[model samples]
Target chain A: MTEKKVYNVAIVGATGAVGQKIMKILEEKEFPINKLKLLSSINSAGKELVFNGKTIIVEEAKPESFEGIDIALFSAGGSVSKQLAPEAVKRGAVVVDNTSAYRMAENVPLVVPEVNNEDIQKHNGIIANPNCSTIQMVAGLKPIKDAYGLSRIIVSTYQAVSGAGVNAVNELENQSQQFLNNEELEANILPVKGDKKHYPIAFNALPQIDVFQDNGYTFEEMKMINETKKIMHDPELSVIATCVRLPFFTSHAESVYIEVDKEGVTVEDVWKELRNAEGIILEDDPSTQSYPTPLSAANKEEVFVGRVRKDLDNDKGFHLWIVSDNLLKGAAWNTVQIAQSLIKNNWLQG
Target chain B: MTEKKVYNVAIVGATGAVGQKIMKILEEKEFPINKLKLLSSINSAGKELVFNGKTIIVEEAKPESFEGIDIALFSAGGSVSKQLAPEAVKRGAVVVDNTSAYRMAENVPLVVPEVNNEDIQKHNGIIANPNCSTIQMVAGLKPIKDAYGLSRIIVSTYQAVSGAGVNAVNELENQSQQFLNNEELEANILPVKGDKKHYPIAFNALPQIDVFQDNGYTFEEMKMINETKKIMHDPELSVIATCVRLPFFTSHAESVYIEVDKEGVTVEDVWKELRNAEGIILEDDPSTQSYPTPLSAANKEEVFVGRVRKDLDNDKGFHLWIVSDNLLKGAAWNTVQIAQSLIKNNWLQG
Candidate 1:
């Protein structure tokens, strides 16, 4: 066979934490690329990023920046994606957006390559990357859904501050120091930066992760509710989420309670499926005191799940502990994986 | 009411974080103490502790040290309590043990004053303070349990590092700085110091809190499980615990799912009982985004409960979020409160 032609790639918001992770993943994956364009906000533009030993200048992201690019990875803020994602799509580039912009959109396909790669073929130019929390939950639940059929899911997330943004990461650091020194703590970031009050996260747990929606659920909670149904393609699946931001910086831990449709599914059966599933590393041996911790999964790409047990009274009910790096499996790496899937399936040529 | 005779009180583990807090609480509550005696291990003995504008020399703890003491608050360590609590009791001192030594003993009354103050009178010689996670959970559930009988509880705790000991608190501070400086993290104190391996807790979550038991629960988890039954005085009550140590230094937050014996108990009813309950702050307003956070409750003595909601499909199922400073309501404050209750009820004899 003749050598495959390399495609041009553009990274939106290349200066951001998730954007930088996307760039690193692309290089590590050795994605086929003829031209690599790095784009960022006006404030971050003109900065040079060295990727794969090549110096690339980050230009201001705009509608014109996507010209002649085959794939655009968007990890910028939601507002930036909302403004330029459609423009990039109009310029004949397929967009893998890492924000919550088009995740619930009717036309955009929210794809997790391992769970819903078939959905990518139906995307109308823009593919939405599921929320970091939602992605890991679905990644772990997809195999169970296929085998036993899920009826209800209730998830309470122990999310990291990095999910809010890079500034939040900095806020956690400063507040931690103030707490240790017995100095006055000044909180400016956690439990929704735009919210009226800020609380110190250094020695605390905040039940709210994002701004509250009209439905009494935070935006992050709503994201998990809506995205779970969309990713599973089951509009009738019952899902509820309570998202909390802990002082953790990277990985997100979730206490997930699920009710499977089929009866007689034991904990061992679920463990067998999860252990054999792709992109899942089952770190669940309670006997030997083995389970996934956010610390152990901080830099890892695989979703680690443990603490699997059947609900005491309900035969069909089960509880699972899921943990993964919110930045990796939840955002940047998933975006890059979608791009890889698109190329492997020849869906980008449309 | 002949001038309400003040008793002499001694506090062991005077150099620990819980000891410091106990001193503060004793001062704030204006405990009827004619003399405040501070004691510690030989290593920390001779250190001066300031309380109520006076510095007291911390003497080495021994059976002879409690000769004239009326009440002794012991939080040194389980081993120390196992060795010295009985000795102090034999010397005519009523001991409030904060360690796990006498918590589950048939004769040692485990008391959370707000939940079971009447049980304090049954103490043989020593009273046991419940686990921090268990204290908050029982405090929040006591009012509900009084109003509506309880059936089962499943709790997943997001605990702070201070519960592990002062060294864990210092480790969290140092590791947090290392994370901010982009340096490799060092671990020595988390997930039980005596465990074979240690993990970083700066920006991470550890699934194991205390050491593991044969039944797959950590010792901390078992404490929550066993202490809940003892404190609630319902040994038949089913409880499961998954204790996790987050990077936080003070407050412990728990996601508690409970099945009430009575059906159709609305969230409003639960809120009503909690709002009017003693030593509990009901913070369940979901409209103004008002809820209890660990930061707000860190230094406060009250147990904060919020996010009260009924499970969607189960009429008897309810979920509540509980937060409290483990060092305070969980240990030191609880011990002090027990001592006060004993005196108030004439259970202490000098």
Candidate 2:
């Protein structure tokens, strides 16, 4: 075996939901680390987080924070990622950003490990973790695309409030309490926190997930549309998305409809491919009532897929229900996986 | 008005969720009822329901209950409707069935008032109310179908627990309380009460709305498929549905994708048609963050539609978000509307 070189890892926004998960994942994964740094926004500085049985103090992230870092895992807001990703890269740290800032940049690779692990090698100092919804979808689609050259995809997402951040999760809890008590529910941080209007997500389904683009699709929907093409390396693939925020707290689920290029593909064919795919769990026997709800997929790392069936009207069309812990496989795990891929493939140096 | 005739009306399954809504709608519409009868299953026969300041005692429905009734609105289970609908018709009363018993019986007309109110005229005795999801979707699609002529429909529903009836609503309440307290959830009803498995609906989504058929689609899905074809009077229309049960108390929302037969049907063109469509509220203004969530559309009678956009890849493909009260427009209001149509068109005497 080759001599192991440990990484000096730093986590940006270490107090956020995805950030906390990253710390726990790095610990659970037993990744080799010479030193671990916890960095957060100014407001979240001075906080203490326990990692690997040691209490680490979170410091304010600044220009000099990335010094002596080998891999910086970022789950900070988009503005923070925009400001610090390049600075970290310039300091010789490879960034696996969990924000949308660098995802579509031509030089940055938007990746789902199962779908495009090779893309990680092509990253220029920084790599992007695709949207939570996009990561689960691309992971589920990778096997299908390899078996039957894809044509089109139409997806509807049932996303958890955790994707909006910890504040939205608290809002869902508070609003649900208010609703159960027959009191007036308050809405502050849901659907889109930065948008002008906020909607209650307790026992309600909001069709908008992110700020809407001028073309009428929300940014989350557009990310799914654009990022799927990039991750699959199929620029001509037809992708459309409708993303909705639900009351769930952890796992995000999607109802996907796809038209494959191959005509003779059956449900068994799709199931066989999905069962054999990396990082996918198939819980799909209809007679046994086997399927994955969001609650069932929570705290798990793999993408859970079920309810695979052929379209009644279109022979080439098939439907699948894909679910995953958005904070894990969708964000933190994918980021750390990229870091691991970099080290394993000896592609760490710029 | 043409010498108003007070008809004798009976409400079957009068203790049910939709049946109670039918009673309220009848009182609100001030339908000239000469006599009112409330009927339920033997288990709930002695319950009391109030209508127009009078407490009406619910009685067990038998074949003889329709002897003096002019119109009967049935929201009972399918077996009850299958047993008594023909009997009520034989006893000289027209039955507007809110069950799925005879929806595709070839002789019965599946009616959505805005889309196919004229179909009520051809009812020999029992006119079928379409499925809750189907009713809202077809009502939203009516004007577009008229303007552009639709060829195909693909819908994924976010249905409230109330669509499963009172027990499901109670289950949601119980499961929610259990979830909030961090206790083990005991789910006795949901996603098909009689199915082998019961999944908790609080903060979770069940992709199977009803029991799975041999083809892997749920009964609720097949209902949407068969009923849409029947209500549209088009046997050739391609339709597919994926029905899911959500945790909301009322209102069913759908993410609908349609292919219009006419070429170059823009979003503005579809919006123009939807603006004038009867019983439809056009709520699509993404710039203003105006859209209909389940909570916003809960108590309303009209079908609330928003998020209308043209698919980027398929010019003929248009996506719509459709929502309406499952108890009102979905079942009860549509049934009441058919009864009023029967009275208005002087087709009451079968």
Candidate 3:
């Protein structure tokens, strides 16, 4: 019989929304862990969090925080990851970064385990998690693409406030109550927190997700466009994204239109592939009024796909609704799965 | 100065959501009404409503109610329009229907004043108003289509609860409050009041907007697809839609992707055309984070368009976000505008 191995695991930004979910998911998954360290910024330091019945105090993350850590999961801001990721890597800790800091880096492998788990072997001490919207989308599309080759994608996202963090979720709650009471909605954080402008996200849809790039696409839209190609290893693919932030607290629902390369692909053919794929649930039955909604998908780890229909005009075109919990599968669950893959594949050494 | 001719006008379904908005718009526009009549179902017949400082008693609509009426606006329901519209037309009254009863009727002209006002002249005593979601989309696209010929359209709508009328709006409000209070949401009206199943719309996205058709498309989705082609006077235009009911109470927003037949169309070209168009407001500015949201577009009559971008890959493809009040420009204002156009163009004799 082979002996089981457990390694020390560390979670950066442990007090943040995604970081907190990471703690819960790690405990729930019963990950093999010899030790666990919770680290955050100076403001969130000293916060106590329970993991697997043990209370751990979040320590201020520094370069030495990774000295004894075998794996580090980062979900802090991009700048924090930019500053601390290499420092942790220098201390011999493999990182599965959940920020956009190192996603497009030439050496780093941007991955969604369901789509491209083998990419973990190419990691140079850092495996990048794609954007929340991109992760669910690619996870849903990977199955269809495998059955019939994919050429183009156009998606419009109905994203939740939780994707922005815990503060944004609180802002939505406060603004919604204020709206119901006929009080003026106070907008402190939304659309983009660090951006110059702020908009109330309660009972409204904000077309902007991240900061706008020079090309007129928001950073979130560009991430979906670029990271999708990188993760799918298809540089020639045509992808476009419109990322909008809605007032929901959890889960993102996307309306995706794709053009497969092959001809004679019916809805059933696509459904067959999706049903056979891992980490995907097909909930489409028009007769029964069955489909996945954001509320139904909240807290779920697998991506829920529904509203599958072949386009009336184009033989290659198909539309799908893809949904999942932004905190779980989109970030925390995906990050933890990469670490598990790393350990199982014996690819922890970069 | 020419003395404006006043006519006897009747408003059917005066107590409903769109009906109430119609009253407000009629009073605000001062539609040169010599005598105004309010009519509704027998259940709401005795209710009192005020219009322009005049208290009016609602009367039950019957076959003979339109005896001397020069114009009648119908918004009660499809069954009411199906039964009362032809009777109203038979009694020397021109009917502007805000229901789906005659939208696709071969002889009926489904009209949006900005896009196809001339279709009003072709009306045979009945002018059908386009769907709320369709009205905003076509109004925003009319200019772009005229400038660079339109070939195909793909749209995903974030529609408000009010589009389904007052009951659905109340469902959203009650569900929202219940959700906030940690109580179970009782959803009796949503997605479609007539559909078999009901789902809560508070803080959630319902992919099904209306009852599903056998083709895997909802009735709302089919409305957008079929109405766009009919109003554009192009039978060969490729159109596809996915309609979703969101939690908001006022406006309908659409993320539209279109392919122009003409090549070399730039973002500025599209913006210029939208700015010059009569019913569209161009609010696209990436640097200032300027774009129209549902809350911002509510209660306005014109269609607000923003986030216009040429597709990154397809030269002829463009993406736009279109928004407007589902009641104002979508229903009440557009219906009133058709009546006004009939009076102006002297087409009431049809």
lDDT: which candidate is best? 3
TM-score of chain B of each: 0.98, 0.98, 0.98
lDDT (0 to 1) per candidate = 0.87, 0.92, 0.94
On residues B1-350, what C-alpha lDDT tens digit does candidate 1 reach at each position?
47868998989898888889999999999999899999999999889888899989999998899998899999898999999999989988999999999999998889999998988888878999988889999998999999999998878888888888889988988988887778999998777888777888888888888887765557887898788898888988988777788887778898888889998898888989998999999887766778888777878989999988777557887878899888899888888889888888798852
- List TM-scores for all candidates, in order: 0.91, 0.99, 0.99
The ten-residue window of minimal lDDT in model 1 chain B covers: B212-221
lDDT of 3 at B345: 92
Residue B4 accuracy (lDDT) in model 2: 72
What tens digits encode model 2's per-residue C-alpha lDDT throughout B52-88?
9999999999999999899999998999999998889
C-alpha RMSD (angstroms) for model 1: 3.0
Candidate 2: lDDT of A82?
A: 95
Candidate 1 lDDT, A1-350, residue by residue in tens: 79976989999989999999988998999999999999998999999999999899999998999999999999887899999989988999999999888999998999898898999989899999999999999999988888888998878788988988999988887887777778998888777888887877776788988887754567887889889899899888988787788887788999888889999998889988997899999988756668898878888899999888777557888888899999999998899999999999899954
Q: Please, what are the lDDT tens digits per residue for candidate 3 over residues B276-331?
A: 99988899999999999999998888899999999999999999999999999999
Docking class of 1: acceptable
* Cα lDDT for residue A57, candidate 1: 90
Using Cα atoms, each model's DockQ against the true complex is 0.43, 0.86, 0.90
Give each prediction's root-mean-square deviation over alpha carbons: 3.0, 1.2, 1.0
Give the residue spans of candidate 2 off by over 4 A: none
